[model samples]
Target: MSKYFAVLLLLIFSTQIQALEKVTLQLKWTHQFQFAGYYMAKEKGFYQEEGLDVIIVPADPNNPNVDFRVLYGQAQFGVFHSGLLKQRLEGKPFVALAALLQSSPYCWMVKAQSGIYVPRDFQGKRISLLGHTENGELLMMLQRAGVNTDSMLLYSGKKPFDDFIAGKFDAMQVYSTNEPYQAQQLGVATREICPKQFGLNVYADVLFTTEAMLRDRPQQVMRFRRASLKGWRYAMLHLEESLAVTKANYATHKSLAQLAYEAEKLKDFIRVSGIPIGKMSAAKWLWIAQLYHLDVSQFHEHKADFIYSEVKQDPASLSWVLIIAAVLTLVCIPMYIQLIFSRKNKSHLR
Candidate 1:
């Protein structure tokens, strides 16, 4: 009876130990190749291996605010653009974990026949930035090129892309990886005035979480980062497989061919000059801060805590400790039970 009881207790402890920690990841946009790494992570058991059950929440177009979701604790982690630096400077306790895109995918798209080859050419033109009120990179690019952003006629209305296709706007902001391919499918010959071309490059699709999570659950943050980056490496290497996983599950809205195009364009951004995917440098962040005209001294002050550092703890050590505790409990409990039985028997015999 004692042996069975011990076994039951061990089973209960094992069940408790095997239970995974649940966490939510808020995406910056709808399910697509842009978030393929996260999809692959969940699909390939990377998160499971890290003892995590990650709930990937795709952004609703009506409520597309990844930063808010994470800040308010609706999600533990989120993906955002370099605008994250702007938020950080605003006293938000956010920490950047990884920057998946070494180069910003944003660019200004114009009809090839429009003769607008550069940012300077955008002066006095009707521009639509997909209804975005804040895009510092593009505005900075135009500003540097001597174009008054206020001088340009800005369109803020529904279906900006359709309006651009209809020749209602001279130029519109676009994702080099996504919109260009979309335009190609529609047989629209378009040219992109990418910020990178003018040497105003910045990071995109940065994985981040609030500093509280990093402080309170450091191990979980490290595990999630490890698994997420591993998933990104795998997705980069096996693009076709990742695309299949994304389409079959997360991004049924995107066609394989379109995903393939996005993957192709994203390769340079993801794997820049053999630099490891998701690696970030303080120098780069500071440069981005300078571009945003934020207080560089403030960034310098908080950067130590803003960037991620690995928590040096062995993943298997905790498991070993738990196993040892279970084994000790199993043995000691039965022995104690046997001792109790012996005492009771002696009393009865007496």
Candidate 2:
């Protein structure tokens, strides 16, 4: 009897241990303070506490295609640019889980004394950007300012800012956190031209997952977001602790000073004055789609409950009066008949 009881207990323990659902997350770029929230969540046992065994994977620096990892079965979730909407517009089944960076940190950079102070100055200049993000917004800024790109020379490649500092180009696209710090270290004075200054709103660093994941495992999805946001809040409040956790576990080439600088600089990028973290408005998504000129006619989506969350939506009071179509047609028919009789009277008089 004792031996049978021991064997049954062992089988139950093994089954409970195996019950934890495993998922992998792919990061957009190489590991750094940029991904500190995820690192904090992992190190602080938040994922484990949620009954998740998350495997965090960093992209190869040479190949930083993050969305495809989530789109395929290679990974269930990823942090990527809001430009993922372009793929979503194409009918791909990717659902945005959260907005990591409320504001985009991308801008055009040049030497401080390069005499290029405004978006208009980018006309007839050579420019290169690292990623596909914000490229459309940049062009729209120039176009709105009456700056022509016909004389513009563009290059799509990696690390163009180094070439920018070498005087191989007039201006290069840079993230406010990374390149400006590098230029400062190299004694290159760079003046960053921000898109927000030109009336462009961009969303960056979006967290997304597959439709299958969200649809099948909604409870786990909510758990992941809750824990991840908790991790982000802790990281922002405890910068040094988060950085220490990240650096100790993750491999990166950046020095301690560089990582620390990124941690401090990224706070502004992620935090808004009054908005909650991970909050996204449908207006923002629609504005981005408009900026990119994406045709979303097929989406047939609405603004209500646009973002996925566990919070119950408060019922909206009837703000709009429903106008009956039959009543509208009845009101217009008299005008239509009068116009036809008036035209007939004019014809008779002629």
lDDT per model, in order?
0.86, 0.75
Top candidate, metric lDDT: 1
State the RMSD for candidate 2. Answer: 22.5
Model 1: per-residue lDDT, tens digit, 1-350?
Answer: 66766776777667655777899999988988988888888899999877789999999878776698899999999999888888888899999999999888888999999999988898889988544423568888999999988777888879888888999889888888788898999999998998888898699899999999998888889989999999999999899999999889988988899988988888888988868999999999999999888899999998998888777885643864586677778777877898899999999999
Q: Assess candidate 2 and give its lDDT.
A: 0.75
Summarize candidate 2's per-residue lDDT along 1-350 as a digit string, tens digits: 35544655565545445655798989988888888888888789887666678888989867776788888879988888867777776767777778888877777888988889998888888887445654567667788899887668877655576677878888777777788899989988878887777778677778888778877777777777777888888888889888787777884577788888887777887888887877887778888777777765533362232345564431211111122233335545765787799899999999
Q: How many clashes (backbone N, Cα, C below 3 Å) per candidate?
A: 0, 0
Q: Which residue ranges in model 1 land beyond 4 Å of their true spot?
A: 1-17, 130-134, 314-317, 320-350
Could you tell me the lDDT of residue 279 within candidate 2? Answer: 82
Pick the TM-score winner. Answer: 1
For candidate 1, the TM-score is 0.86
Error of 1 at 64 (Å): 1.6
